[model samples]
Target chain A: MTTLVSEAIRAPYDFLAWLVGLWSDALYAVGDALGIGMLEYVFMHHAFLVGTLIAVMAPLVGTFLVHRQMALIGDALAHTAFAGVAVGLFVNSILGTGISPYLTAVVVAMLAALAIELISEVTDAYNDVSMAIVLSTGFALGAVLISVNTGGLAVGINQYLFGNLATVSRENAVLLVVLFLLVSVVVTVTYKQLLYVTFDETAARVAGIDVTWYNRLMTTLTALVVVGAMQIMGVILVAAMLVVPVAAAAQVARGFRESLLASVVLAQIAVLVGITLSYRYEATAGGTIVLVAVAVYIGMVLAGKLQSRRGVSEEAGTGSVAREIDAGTGESTDD
Target chain B: MSLEGIPSVGVGGVETSRESAEAGEGRRGEGTADADRVVDAVDLTFGYAAAPVVESVSFGVDRGEYVGIVGPNGSGKSTLLRLVLGLHEPDSGHARLLGHPSLAFAERERVGYVAQDVTENTKRMPITVAEVVLMGRFPHAGFGRVTETDREHAREALRTVGIERLADRKITALSGGQRQRAYIARALAGEAELLVLDEPTVGVDAESVDAFFDLLADLNDEGMTILLVEHDIGAVLERASRVICLNREVYFDGSPAAFAGSDALERAYGTNLGLGAKTETDSRGDGS
Candidate 1:
């Protein structure tokens, strides 16, 4: 009976599968023309798909976190997710269940996110302190869990730790697709409200925007993005995707929406190129992706400095006239 | 000071207009003085770490009144505003906003608040002036997209604050005075009946400070009840119809002239405040 229900669902799934096949064929044709033979493998296709989805999600959520100066939240959540994965493994061994560790990571990461928020709100502790406490606790828990379950769990944990491209199973890729859609819809629907809260939470509260709810929504979304990115970017380097692309985007973009858009574009470029490089060199996919993102960030910083210097030089032609205007208006302390 | 919770004694048997809707019109006939009172704080007391910041402060702001609250630094000026806005709960007494207990005040859009020097928090955000102003419309928009009417109101608010030209400019790029104006525009865009400003001109240039007060005076003249918490006693006294002198308590609540005449300033601030300068200068010329 369950098979019949699945069969009914299989029709649309098969249609989707067929469409994905057509797209993959087109990508392969491009790869053949470009002479990048690694792109034709089924595992390579999975890696690229997961990477692209992660690229879209990381910066979409990261821009808000970065702007709020909570960039380390992604790192904290990722480490918490590692503990969650350990719990899943331990529980599965005990119960003889075959549940995916990523599922448990999602649950654990979300709880940790809420815990982070609650600790800060209740104690009036700075957000970083909350993050630091949670980070240490989470890493310690994961380490203990792994040590205790060394016989059963030690084999497959490295894939989550450093991310292996070949380890992104079809089921995990499908899960990532679901996560991408969920995150995209949520972030899009709540974009304006989140932006309002992100800019000035006190004013947003005064404006009756349910600031706490949006804050929770943002942190929850961060947890979800951290889990999704973990499949490809790994536990350690997942947050790099969240922060580096946004840092680069901020150097170039003048507005919030522009920054968000540019970050996604930058992340996409980094992910695709990183995946290709990792595939060719048999390197850790997460590290390669982060390295590319960092390189782009450095490039943007240099470019921004050069562009501003040129502007200053052009203003120098007008003597102290430009300087006078700038002096009249106090320098911005935005960063 | 021991960090112990003070028992909050809420006002009892005070019927909200909603609860007593059937008899509200009849009560109005009895002249209970509830018609125009935007804020009515009765013996409000708040503290942090069991040390009182606002101690048994009470004041009422009637409709169309510009009330300026003046106090020395850390004398609970901002804390008093927070109590009225329900951002902080008073420990020992009650505060009502628009005839409802502040915590239960449902008409959120009716009261607007401009916090002190939020520029530090907002500067890093890459938001445009219009977008910041549009946030004022959030309560009215309510899970719906901002309407064209909302945008028009935001634009009009910008025009009112005389920063309509900077509407498209990023908030981080604006001058201190311009940012303050933009914040005022954000509050104004809500079209609230009561505007609560907490030191809205801290970093403004001298020339712009005069202009900022002029804008507030203009808003008050147009019937928006303004509660301004200011450190610039002289400028605020010149504009506000009533002055509320607070130093952890309500020292005086009366006309600005009476505030000048009374020793409340000296008692509250522990000094004859600079408003004395203006008072002495006036007496030197007219001896009245």
Candidate 2:
């Protein structure tokens, strides 16, 4: 049946397969001359490609979420995706189905995202309360399913928990690409609306923008990002990738666009460095990635404090001679 | 532009006809022209639960009227502003904006609102003053990028509030007065005719309060209809052409001089509280 389906959709899949194959082989050839043949493996290629995609997707959505003070939602949805993966595996073993758990994760995570919005809307609960409710419920359900799994279907659960670079298959890589494009397009198209809602929701609402609908769109997009990133970032650290990069960028970036752009650049660097270090050191990919992001965040915080202090000192300078001395010292330091 | 297509849904009068007319007007960038009333509340009642916070409130804000609503704490001053802004649906009766019922009113660019507690809400947000002001153009721009004209409007608004120099400064970095001016600039940038501000001077300094009221006066003189929900009754009476004293209902709706001389203030304040700004010393003395 798998072969029949592949044959039916052969042309497009073949094109994608060939394109990725050629791209990876070209990179491997370059890596061979540099004494870095690690890129030769198909799984390594998948890890890097999917890792890059997640780096872009996570922070792009996370910027708005962070500004709106809904950062915990990312973690909540990631846990829900974990439960979703458990449910998929459980159902597959019970029914002898060959369904992909990642697909189920996407469905479950999006529903949970909507659920968070609905719960907050219907009740007077704070956003964090709703998030905590969903978070605990999701993890508990995952635990229950794991405990109930007598058919040994939970074997791959560890990979989803802490993440393994080798586990991101070609099929899931394709899904990540689709998710990346979807998230990017949505964010780019609705950038202004998102900015309005993020900065001042009441004003945005009065301005005739459908605040609720945009909010749901944002959360659903976050769910997509989480599910796509879960393979590389894992359920536990998935939200770190979403938040840490944006937090670091916010320390320095002057505006939202700059914040988003800088966050993507920062996340990309973290993912690349983390993946390479993990491959070299035989470390867990998710933990390595999140640690790198945290380091970057710390570095940015220290730099921001130093910059603000300098600004204050420059303002407190007495006269033109002190200002000239300050400029000279600044230029000398630049050297 | 005429009020022919203005919606009347929540107001419940010829409502179905308004629904059909609004479908066309909603697309038109320029909505209805002035039909006198910028904000019209007729027997509006609202509450979070069983006991109504505001009940049987009724008033009309004529075009170019700088109407100040004054009330005690929890007297539904903010809620009434929310009702006029279409943030909350009333339990009964109706509120209208630009001659359209609040629920169906969708001419967003024509109206701007500044919420209370904005400074607290935006404490950690990393947006600049210009960016905050640029948000006022969101309604006109929709899902699109801000145009040069939008930028110009934002700059003009900043100039109007005398904070043009601080446009690039981060909102969190501004002083309380500067922050309040930035908020006013945000509302002005939308090119709104009706500006509804809730407690804009709550956290501002004493000097900035005078400047802020003066700026509001300048805007009102320039033909912008202002609805200010203020705690400072004496200050509001000095600036506003009309005063609406609300304690869940319209106690008095008339000129500042009329409200100053009327017994409505004594009744609302439960004493012979001086409503005149000139009697400031006497009022303060009486309160003490």
Candidate 3:
């Protein structure tokens, strides 16, 4: 029965592997046609795929988080996910098991997410002190665990810390695909509830949307996003993918849906361009992507300033028009 | 208008109503007690800390009745409203919304709420006026797609509030008065039987505040039940059919005229001497 269940779960991953193979072959053809050196490698193809998916899911969840002023929650969860990786490595060394560290990270990060939520619920606040404690505890645990292991585990830790583009293995790519689908499907299904909760907790509660449950779900999803992005963006800088693009989009986008779409588009530019630049310069992919995203944010801020300066006069005109209509309708309704 | 025939209950009627509500709660399932009342609170009490914020509050808002709650700043008016809406569970007794226990009241779409300018805090959020109004339909839609009919209702609600022209504009771009109307439109879109507003005109310009009250009067005239919590005693007296003066407890529950005639305002506002002094100074400042 266990084997059957495991096979049932593996079926989708197998299909995703096939899809990844097809993607790599297509990239190879494109590389030959465009004479791109980096796209010739299978690892580069996987890196691009993972980066693209990260761009989509990161901001898709980040939009809700950033608007709610909970952007730091992503950073907090990423640190806990790192601790989770340490736990996995520690247990694997002792037990001689082949369990994926990312799986353990997912489990630990989700638990930490729930802890953060529960603490907030009990204390009636999402204060920075508790979050700081959680973050430090995670990094401290990871450091201690890595020191205690004293072997090849410490050598592989750099990839998880700062992230390595060349380390985007086929299995890691497939895992990300699964996470992308999960995050996308869940967010799509619960979009309205999540949006309502994020926008106004009191009003959402009044609407009977179970604000607490949605909050828990949101944090849990943040844990998943942090873990998935950690494979390429690393533990330290993964949250940049979730926050920076969303902030950039908020600078110019005039509506929630528009901001969400704009953030995804902006993240795509950051990831794709940053990947290419990192390859050219031999820099860390995560650091390059965040730098590009920050640059995009600065550009958006300037554009937003220009738009607002122009919007002032336009808004004054609309204000007068609105008053006129209000007066007209007030009289008509009275009559 | 069914309540029009009932004589205006004066200050003395508070005791009688409490007794009747208690009697009603004693035999709750009899079907005659609370079936017609949209909001029924019988000895409801709640507090965040040691001391009770709302204490032994008892009242019932009949169908289509416009009730306004007025109190001092810390008089637990908002807390009482939260208790009525089941956002905060009462410490003792019970509050019922639309004939069901407030906390367990499942048919949430039947009620609409507009609180004191939440948009002021979320001004940077990129949600359009149309989208905010569309949230009224969210409870109806649940996990399903927002249907065309839902959009039509939202449009109709916007038109009713006379802001259909600005439907596509960002919500934060609107004036405080206009934003409150959009919230009302949201409630209207939901087909809510009861509309609740807590200090709905805070930060609104004086001219717009008058217009906002007129809008409320118009909604009430159209047979919509309204429960309003306002700091502006004059506005509530001018608009509400019934006035509830509260200070941790119900000071008075009666007609607006009766409320004005009684010393309930003085008793409620006088409990906090600093607030009373501040009000005097504020009025003096306004005169100067």
**What's the count of clashing pairs in each model shown?**
0, 0, 1
Sort by lDDT, best first: what order?
3, 2, 1
State the lDDT of candidate 2 residue by residue for A115-170, as single tens digits. Answer: 99999999979999999999998999988998899567567798999899999877
The local distance difference test score of model 2 is: 0.80
As for TM-score, the candidate ahead, 1 or 3, is 3
Task: Supply the DockQ value of model 2.
Answer: 0.25
RMSD of each: 7.2, 8.7, 4.6
Model 1 pairs in collision = none
Best by DockQ: 3
Off by over 4 Å in 1: A1-26, A29-36, A307-335, B1-33, B271-288
TM-score of chain B of each: 0.84, 0.82, 0.85
lDDT of 2 by residue, B43-119 (tens): 78899999998887766676787889997778799999999888899998888898788889988989988766575
lDDT of 1 by residue, B1-288 (tens): 000112221221122112222222333454546767888887788998789999877667778889899978899999999889887778988888988898777778788888766768655666678888888887888777789999999998887777776777677767677777788788888889999999988887787677677777778877889999998777766788777777786665666666666566666666555456546524533432
